[model samples]
Target: MLTIDNVSLKGINRPRLSNVGLSLDSGKLIGLIGPNGAGKSSLLKAIAGVEAASGKLLWNRQSLSAMNDNERANTLSYMAQDDTPQWDLTIEDIIDIGLLKKRLSRSERQRRVETTSETLNLSEFTGHSIQRLSRGELQRVLLARALVSEPELLLCDEPTNALDIYHQLNVLQLLKKQSEQGRLVMMAIHDIPQAAEYCDELVLLDKGRLVCHGQPFEVLTKENLAATFGIHADWICNKRGVAWQPRPL
Candidate 1:
């Protein structure tokens, strides 16, 4: 389980997050939804140990601050909003680098790379340079890289930003699969319907404060959506009587 205790971030005396507290259990897909500049990305960064903030981030009852760099890196994988690769390296090479400094045999590393590539439908583009790939393809490559490490917790920021509907669903399905397999998957999302469809729990934020944190039906209501997003929408049940679809506000 991941426990965030009164986590707050301040920049030059301004607070980005204010006394935030939340807990995430394994085998759950948690979506963080909020308007622009609501500190969704900041919250993910703090949980991933990539940002300095006050308060406690604990993993399994142990303080995350106590974990060394390698320990933290090994346990959590963070995929940033802008996951573009800067190096002039092939996709295969980029995926291979996710293993860190581990001394795996050449064949073992190749196997892992191949498996990850196949899982994310990047097997054909493994030889292509990252700089040459399109935005959606690049996102998939980065996701493959993150999965190659097989961390206990997966943190993604706006993961579906550049993908079309097909790949968007694909990525969400992948996250759901990982969560079902007992990995904690948390992502900051901008699309309300996507979060409603795929997430097991929703953490709604407004101006760096948590507005609601619960199941999708409980948190993604019309009132909350209007209050946080400043839009009115009708929340309707799907044909199967599960999940929600929001009409224009």
Candidate 2:
């Protein structure tokens, strides 16, 4: 389990996060939903040890702040919203970087890279430079790097921002599978209906505070849609799937 107690981050004008608290469990896919500047990325960074926030983040009863760099890297993997490679590294090189800290032998490393590449549909682009691929392909490469290690906790920010509709759903399904395998997968995604359908729980944030946290039906109510997203919408859930239909304004 991940325990977040009174986590807060300072900003130049106002606070980025204020006393945000949540107790998340493993084997669940959690969606971090919020509007722009709602501190969704900040909260993920705090939990991933990328941002210096004042709070107690305990991973499975152990404090994340006390863990060293290598220790934290082994425990969790973070995928940023904007991960552009400066150098034109090949897809194989980029994916191999995820296993740099692992003590796996040569054959094991190759096995991991091959498996991850195939899973993300990147096997054909092994030797291709990242600069030559499309935005969506690059996004998959970044996701492959995050998944190659198979960390216990995965934190991703806007992971599907650059993907097509098909790839977006495919990746979300993959994330759901990751959680089903006993890993905690938390992602900041903009697709409300998809998040509602796939995620086991949703953590809603607004104005740097946690508005609500629960199942999709509980958190994505009419009031929350209006207050957080400034819209009037009706949430529909049935055998087909989940959808938030926006009413005519």
Q: Model 1 segments beyond 4 Å from truth?
A: 101-103, 240-249
Candidate 2 colliding pairs, count? 0
C-alpha RMSD for every candidate: 2.0, 1.1
Error of 1 at 245 (Å): 7.2
Taking all chains together, each candidate's TM-score versus the true structure is 0.94, 0.97
Clashes of each: 1, 0
Candidate 2 C-alpha lDDT tens digits along 1-249: 999999999998889999999999999999999899999999999999888999899999999999987888799998989889888899988988888888899999999999999988888897999999998999999999999889999999999988998889889989999999999999998889998999999999998999999998899988888889988887787999888788644
Candidate 1 lDDT over residue span 1-249, tens digit each: 999999998755467798999999999999999989888999998988788989999999988889997888788888888876679999999988788855679899999999989988888886898999999889988888778888899999988889998989899999999999999999999888778888999999888888999999899778998898877776666665344444456
RMSD of 2: 1.1
Indicate the TM-score of model 2.
0.97
Q: lDDT score of model 2? A: 0.92
